[model samples]
Target: MKTAAIRALPASATVFPILFMISTVHLLNDSMQSTVTALFPVLRESQHLSYGQIGLIAFMMNITASFLQPLVGWFADKKPRPYILPIGVCFTLLGVVMLALAPSFAMILLSVTAIGVGSAVFHPESSRVAYLAAGSNRGLAQSIFQVGGNIGSSLGPVMTALIFIPLGQKGVLLFVIAAVAGIVLQTVVARWYAAVGAAPKPKKAVAHDEKSALKLSAGKVRMSVGILILLVFSKHVYLSSFTSFYSLYLIDDFGVGKQQAQWYLFAFLVASAAGTFIGGPLADRFGRRNIIWLSILGTAPFSIALPYADPFWSAVLCICAGFVLSSAFSIIVVYAQELLPGKIGLVSGLFFGLAFGLGGLGSALLGEIADHTSISTVMHICAYLPLLGIFTLLLPKDAELRGR
Candidate 1:
């Protein structure tokens, strides 16, 4: 876990620790949030929220998390990441517990805040460690680390289903388990790093000096930023239309129930993880830009072709789409980080936080569009966004233009 270039921790130490750290934080959130959202309609009926209110609540949570990300990234650059981690885990644990016990709007709002707080805290710090782990081969290191995100995502609906059903209140116990587990993991990581014999680097912002402050050169920085935003737009549309809503289409059009759709989604996500795991390392082996563009092109037609399929074909296309989508997640992350090597935390926040935050917005917008237009149209439109991204990729090769 030491930052040194020579004699880095073996893969056993480097990969697993980073993976566990990133995955655990996301695992906690994903496990709980899915349950909360799936049950949201039922909860909303019981709670008597207006559509606006529900939308506002989601917006509140996201905006709160989104706004705080840059500052968190800045702080992570200066602080010991693990030191702050326990607190974030505790916040998630608190939020989940409060959510389980919640009886009123105020309480639920408070719980959402807790969830947002925990989420904001984790992204930047976790990315820092993952980047650190990739000391020599940052791409592979990030691929291993990025697996945590895909695993957590796949588990979200599954765990949520379990928590809400068979496990009942006990399944809700993931909160306590997550909190306690985090404490243990933190202790182990701390000790592991200690044994490796390096004081954890302080996370102070890379901007301490003017040169490194915005070390990214103006031209490359602008291009990279624009590319990320374009990619973000496409990503958001895919997530909203495919990741979140495709199942709904299956259910509505094909009479697939929540469980079946969820299972399919899980399969899609697993395929995606496989893609990312393979893609990142592959990009390193081949070329980052080439792989990235290839994934975009490869996935676009498949995703666009989704609405035309019957159930069986849809699942196949969905899973194929997953591979293409997953491949980009880690690659883009490493792509962003290398572009701003010294600003790993900030870059991670931009890649993950902004991309996802905007994606969430895209999700919401799609939901609203679903109200006025057919879900079919939304899916169709979603299909083309990624295609547009292919044009954006041609702007300048990310590798050639990074960090100015």
Candidate 2:
């Protein structure tokens, strides 16, 4: 089955138009979804919600997306669904509308679940689209796709500060336009995919031999996959602390206003967006393992320093932490695709699912810790997570192992 799917596709010429189109839709879709997190402080004030409850809200949305994504990808891999993209954006549109009018916490959860479902549908298919459009430059293609989401994620806090915070939750309604735009854009992309998505043009004979040389035993492949999953776990757990609670941390520790804290979060995420672009081209040249190692582990010093720094230094360290860590994800995704050539959709889904799931669980658990102990303490504890990058030693070197 996998072999058939691989053979159906011919390698493509790098399709810049399709890549840019999908990335634009990604920016729109994620900007809507991330707007929820950006509004957390306001939601807490409006509802008198606890930190634990806030964490649960993130958990609810992410877990919903997490649980469904792998299944969606697995199904799509077996049967390509070119038109599913627009349908997913419709779910996001509905979710945004519901969130704007949400009367109670229960309604908010339901709204986020809709949003999550949309995300679950969106990521795998969109990633596969990036894969199809990549041609020979897979790493750069994934980075181009990913940077849009990072930039969108950064925009959430800014949007919240400028729009939602001022106009109240109803400001979320304006983003419905973005969702509608996404549906239109994705529909066009769907048509493109229907024409060319599965057809990878034949490579030159030497390239074919290189592909054959890259084969690995099932056991080694599985082990590499496990290592990648662990890397995801480490990355997201640390990030969950920031995305879910960094605003609160700034408020508690530095006496910053909520809006100000959001700006800081925006800065960190923007740095992340910058880092995402850098990682891909570097990995394309230097080796994915080297970039992965540096991205996951190299941030440890800054992560450790962030908790103790004064407000200015804290923001600076956070930016450094975000930039260094952010590079790993695109590297990880493209590397995994290289690892399992035919299972692009399934691999994308699984890794993206694990990222959401682990981040959700980490948020939930860390929120409880903050409720009982202190946000400062939680930050101190999470700083140790990137040290797990020591395990990157376990990943097989693709260049070295290609012909073994």
Candidate 3:
């Protein structure tokens, strides 16, 4: 019925309104997710938790978020489910309530898992919706969609420091308001999606472009994807260091107050949001590979220099790193879509899932390292991860594609 409903409607010219609505939903949803990490300091002090325990919370949440995305995308690709968008937000709403009221660590873990499920459900379908609404400007549409999440992530720490820190765990319940907003927004978007016309058809086994230029065999295709995955790992693991622990790093290393540290985090994430908005347009103009190269590899010097800077200088370095590093992921997603041509959902899910999984694992492992060693040491270690972006050399040049 949903598929038929979509099929009956005509394709939209652009549907910027729907795209913006979906992006707003992404913002609300991710702000709630970012709250988990944002409250680390408060949670640690309140519960007498260790850094490892804090990381474990992130691990539990992100592992579930990451693991199920591919399956969700795979299912959505085969059978479109527009209504699931609001249903997914319901999971997040319930999780928010659970986190607010939970008494034990076990309950917190369960709460995070519920939230993770919502995120896993939300990403692929919403991404497909953005593609449907993209018209001819796929890059701009993707950037607009992604920038919402980055902005939400940027806002989370500030909100946490202001609300959650003073009001205690109960302050988290305030986010239920955002969850409700997400549900209402997503429901409307889902209805619009159901009326957006037929979904993009999936290519059979191989992209036609794969056959024409440079003649990539199955092995080469796999190799190329593997390289992209490695790049994702390098980018995400390094990002995890900041997203999961940067505040703690500031508090411990520089003797910065928790609220001040959050401000620094806000600065970095705002820069990330700006970078995300810029990447897609640049990629659309110059080619995706160029953006990928600059975003992932170009940030290395600042990343390496960040650990050694004073607090003010460190903040500046973080902004610079965030600006450059945050640009690649959206471009990566569009590039992968172009690579496979038809399996948008599957590709979005795979990359998003891997990012979450790596982030979770990296957070957990890095948390343990911080517990055993020092936060400063973790910073220095993560500083060099961006250097691995040199591997981008392995990717095929964008100009070589015979057909886009």
At residue 255, candidate 1 shows an lDDT of 89
Clashing pairs in 3: none
The weakest ten consecutive residues by lDDT in model 1 span: 205-214
Candidate models: Cα lDDT each: 0.65, 0.87, 0.86
* CA displacement after TM-score superposition, residue 20 of candidate 2 (Å): 0.8
Runs of candidate 2 exceeding 4 Å displacement: 1-12, 199-215
Clash number for model 2? Answer: 7
Of candidates 3 and 1, the better by lDDT: 3
lDDT of 1 by residue, 107-206 (tens): 7778767777777777676667666656557678777767766776676556534545444433555557766776566555444433342344435523
TM values, all candidates: 0.83, 0.94, 0.94
lDDT of 2: 0.87
Q: What is the lDDT for 73 in model 3? A: 83
Model 3 regions more than 4 Å off: 1-12, 197-215, 402-404
Error of 2 at 313 (Å): 0.4
Best by lDDT: 2
